[model samples]
Target: MDLNYSPYDFGIHNDPYPVYARLREEAPVFRNEPDDVWVLSRHADVQAALRDSATFSSVNGLRIEPAFWGPDAERFFSFVAMDPPRHTRVRGLVSRAFTHRRVQELEPRLRELARAYLDPLLDGEPFDLMTDFAGPFLADVISELVGVPEADRGEVRRLGAAIMYRDEESTDLPPEALQAIGALVGYYAELTRERARGRRDDLLSGLLDAAEGDDRLTLEEIVGVAILLVGAGIETSMLTLGNAWYAAWRHPDQRARAFDGRVADWIEETLRYDPPPQALARTTTAEVELHGTTLPAQSRVLLLIGSANRDPRVFPDPDRFDLDRDTGSSLAFGSGRHHCLGANLGRLETRIALEEIVKVVADYDIDTDGLRRIHSTNNRGFATLPTNVTARR
Candidate 1:
């Protein structure tokens, strides 16, 4: 467990699976310099830490480099930065709105949305599937679900990109990122106000209702939670959709299964092999020991989720993408109290998206000429996915 392994090194910000595997083998609890963070790379280790919230607290911060706007930014985003009890309270309210049944009920609507957005692109020649299909589709779903007016989806999406894409290393001054954050916060506040009329049945309405209860959410809390949900919901799904398409196009056999309604396994396999979320970070609120290393209070821990997902101990031939493989349970959605609440929703979107893509893309080729990776400490995804798709009919 060397103290010199930097995930930021090895060109990992672009792609880090190889480095992750090396870490798992050499330093399961590798301490990364540059960021002064300890990384947990093994599947079992990551899963255990995720479940053991007491040892590895998330309260201090869940993000790698805390936002530039002081601790208020952290406190405002308490739902994401809080631990157990409080986290459970706020998350429960939102989770109630996104129940399995609700997501399942939304499947047909999602499929319809997918076709409406993609069929035209499919009819035309080559196009960027990420922009044409995934991005728009995810934005539409999140906008509608969050009670944002259909007319405002474009503005919402623009703000979403600004907030989600802005990174610690973003050349734009901190003020620019803060400006983007403010605009999004303003929009969410307005949306909350609108949802307050009690005239909607979407998730936003549910959240507003929950906010009015005894253990109610503060106005800032409501706004922050809304911003997180709106941004996280859409961006994560967009990443999943992009990665799903990439996997199908790369693995033809898996792509064939996807078209035939037997691709859930493939989707699961892809999630295991290349999770949209590469890492999850937690801060130690109290001194704790991990893998013989003492993580002092206030120390940061980065769980290399992508590496854990590909751990050979858990997944045989972990690097290979096999639709038929039996991946018992993967770290794609993470594990523990903070495991992704929208995992089922993400799966539903991916399954239907691939189904529709298969129906249209008889043959497709990834235009690897110029693909860009989203620069971020946590989420692993593509910024732009170029593809040449052929019509099935």
Candidate 2:
């Protein structure tokens, strides 16, 4: 069977699992010549590559797009696009500010934010979950964390959305997206400067104060970290919340179980079954052989995270969204040194949002015909999910 896969293809974005299944069974090391990328579909291959970051480097960024791929990828992805000493140092500094305590401290505020955004929507009117709730909720959370003023949060969120968006089957960043990037960077740079002057009880101030002896983050690094939060933090969490909501809506039994306070399971199952990050790009450091195919040094590789999560070798009944299944092996937040630093915060946000939702929503139905999927290079989620909910009596 002939195999062809392009992450930029809208067809693939619509439903990549069937193609992923075929690639795993037929072409474990599938190559897409048009995109100039090698696709790794098997669980073992993807997991191994993630662990072996030395050979599968992230220096060129975790994307195949010309604009996002290259040595200067650090401009957009921050330390996540760096390797070795650079990555270790930058990540360590950021960690001092982005501590577990910081995330845990947000719990009370997260619940408050969840209810603040979700409460009004329970009046039984149809609302787009993405726009009405998920989008704004995450905007508030990240903005508050990073010290983005409440007045600017809406615009910041809009810019964040523009940066992640792609046209149908588009291969490169659009002009508007580029502008949005510039705007966001400028916004963060100014914010970072402000925080340096008069500190606040927020991550931005914390970042300014974060130091390793005499070593501290540079202005550009702090701005980059803030941009990374907008790019990685907001979009992923918003999409995850929408994905989980849609997943449960599709499966009645699972939906019922989720409503019965299985909110954490709901989040985990949604993450495994339909993770936001479908693929992660890596550049091969040296020649490598896998599945009888040799990948050349510097070749672009797309580790199909969505595919790996569904590999039967790792997950039984892979397509079934069962909350009972162990989802430990899922690469939803990725793995190894480059593993998502915001994983805990993302989960916490989703949990609180959904928990608040379950409290008010007795049952709900998605307007399937009206559902709109966001076209993106790496993320998979809805741009609009219209729904009507039955409020609890």
Candidate 3:
């Protein structure tokens, strides 16, 4: 496609690694003039931009949007999108609650949840893992962490999925997404009051109580952060579980090798191979020169994350989805200040889910024709992945 990459282009968005590899060699610093955004495909370039946050600001937040995508139809901003001090402060406040220990403590809960979801399906039947297992499993975990009432978890999942799976081709949000966002905002807005009224040992309660002297988060900000947490919580695990399993089934040998110690390896490879987040955009603060090209001030550059993860320089035999591929510190969760905050949680969720899947599911085959690729700007994965599984017992 002549280095003029359009994320809206269905074929490229679904599998842009090849084009990214080509661009890494031929046009490492290419520009999509139509979209008015620069493209960075190589690992070094993407990493450099990520590290040099001073030069490339993130005032734009985590809204790494597509050209034709909608306005801030459902604006939900968290610490993830902020720059420096603002990002630092908010992230610090929430980090106290989302600590590594908290995630570690969730291990048993995650394991139990995995079994709870998968065990019922182990009744020798075909099921859409996205709908029946992965989706609900992640939804429940996120709900527990956020302290959402059990009765309301289903509503939260439905709303989160609405935001997760939107029409990418539109310049404005579809009616369904808008309605879902409205409901999410309303629910969280009410939940914020609920948490404020009484205290609990949950992230939502923690967020309600987090502070820096008198400069606490506003009600809107609290709701925004809550929505962001739920959506991010649901999206990553859901995508990783479904994609990792799908990729595993496609490769018999690697799938076989994935049963034990290599389960983490398999999940890591899946992150590098086909991360849910395909790309992210960073706006330049001033004119910067790279690769013999001058990008002017205020230019937005799309870090081809999917491409960077598969960049041949960093990962040998890049395109092949090999679980054994030794990739060094892949940018699957990004890097620097804006790195994914939930990296550990996502890995834990995927690992636990996969461990359970291989236990009861003897052998499963993907329903190729039933696969539905989600059409978000940067997020890539299945909307529906129908799989027919056989039980060991």
TM-score of each: 0.90, 0.97, 0.93
* Per-residue lDDT over 139-254 for candidate 2, one digit per residue giving the tens place of the 0 to 100 score: 78898788889889879878877875556446578999999999989999998888888999999999999999999999999999988887677889989999999999889999
Give a tens-digit lDDT track for model 1, residues 149-235.
878888877766666555434423255556767888888888788777665777667666664256666567677766676546777
Clashes of 2: 0
> Which structure among the candidates has the greatest lDDT?
2
Q: What is the lDDT of residue 27 in candidate 2?
A: 93
Q: Highest TM-score: which candidate?
A: 2
lDDT of 2: 0.90
lDDT of 1 at 326: 83
**Per-prediction backbone clash count:** 0, 0, 2
lDDT (CA) for every model shown?
A: 0.73, 0.90, 0.79
Residue 190 CA displacement from its true place in model 1, Å: 1.4
lDDT of 1: 0.73
Candidate 3 lDDT trough over 10 residues, lowest sum: 65-74
